[model samples]
Target: MPGRVFLTTPVAEIAARFGLDPEPVANEPPRQNISPGQTVVALTPEGLQHMRWGMIPVGRVNARGRPVMETIVNARSETVFDKSAFAGTGRAVLPVDGWYEWTGERRRKIAWRIRSAEPGLLFFAAITDTWTAPGGQVVPQIATVTCEPNADVRPVHHRMAVIIKAEDVPIWLNGSEERAAQLMNPWPDGRLVVEAATGVDWSDT
Candidate 1:
């Protein structure tokens, strides 16, 4: 579900690599572990910005018409477009050095760090939404898109984040919905390296 990730690369380096202008707000430190509800960097139409990890849909409301906070951290790529909350608004990417996943029996689980073997830095296809509170405050939130796990990731989990290639950044950010949907597939096997992570806590690292 891509619940935890780490970003050791400087934000400027990631922005430069993707040609993202204006730069991301330097509001976060180099994190070895980040969980849901925390702020994270994302490349959006407003350039680079810090957004809450779990997306709160735009139209969530209570009986009194007050905004409700919903934590949606992962969107399945297969049906992202079909979901009203994600359709048409699912655009963005989260850059990270790697992500953590666990395997083995419930009591003997082991954490594994998975990352690209070549570039090391990878981008997770994501979606964002701007929700307004009754107090007139606007908050931007994001959720990662997930796809069927590849051979390397299947043993650890049934799903994995949709990893976008560097060359397809433009298409993912501004391409047609059909085109974007085409790119929402599992990353090819062998491009990723998975290893046991030592001395790292998935909750807070």
Candidate 2:
């Protein structure tokens, strides 16, 4: 499964396509090192906004009142509705220009980038939770919803994000979790293009 993604789409374009007012934040900044815990833009009822990449539930704080663990960054799409982590009102969209995957022999890891076959953004379905801290402070967290790999990605990874097409965005965002689950299967062939890496070391930290 992909752990890092890149979004090169201009912020204004992303916001316009998703129907959100663009923030003053500088136009789409290329994200080459989108690791977990990094802030990323996500879609919500309040419109598109930025949120922490990892998901931390409300009461999971530790002794010093900090978050208890590394955020739950990705949720398997098939199990999201059933898991306590993303049940109920959980829903979101993790838009990306594409994502990076690592593959190689034995211990070597090579990185490859996957993007849409055409010029547009891809929306990875996700779920978010808003939790209130012990001090009554609230914070938002999210996890990317994942699905079984499509033919193109099966060799590189066993899981892939549940990509929501433009037409399905409303259903995914507004329908019941069960309805959203119904859309979690691997997309049809040709929906994505895999760019193989020729000679790149993806194992470097």
Compute each candidate's TM-score over C-alphas.
Answer: 0.88, 0.82
lDDT scores for all predictions?
A: 0.82, 0.75
Candidate 1 similarity to native, TM-score? 0.88
User: Residue 19 of candidate 1: its Cα lDDT?
Assistant: 70
Write one digit per residue (lDDT tens) for candidate 2, span 143-188: 8888888888887788888888888988898887677767888867
Model 1, span 1-205: residue lDDT tens? 6879988888877777767663456655788888888988888755789988987665654445666466689989977887555544648888899899988889998889998888768989998887687899888889999999999888889999999987887788888889999999999999888999887755573
Misplaced by over 4 Å in model 2 are 24-28, 58-70, 105-107, 131-137, 197-205
Give the winner by lDDT.
Answer: 1
Q: Which candidate number has the best TM-score?
A: 1
Candidate 1 residue 94 C-alpha distance from true site, Å: 0.7
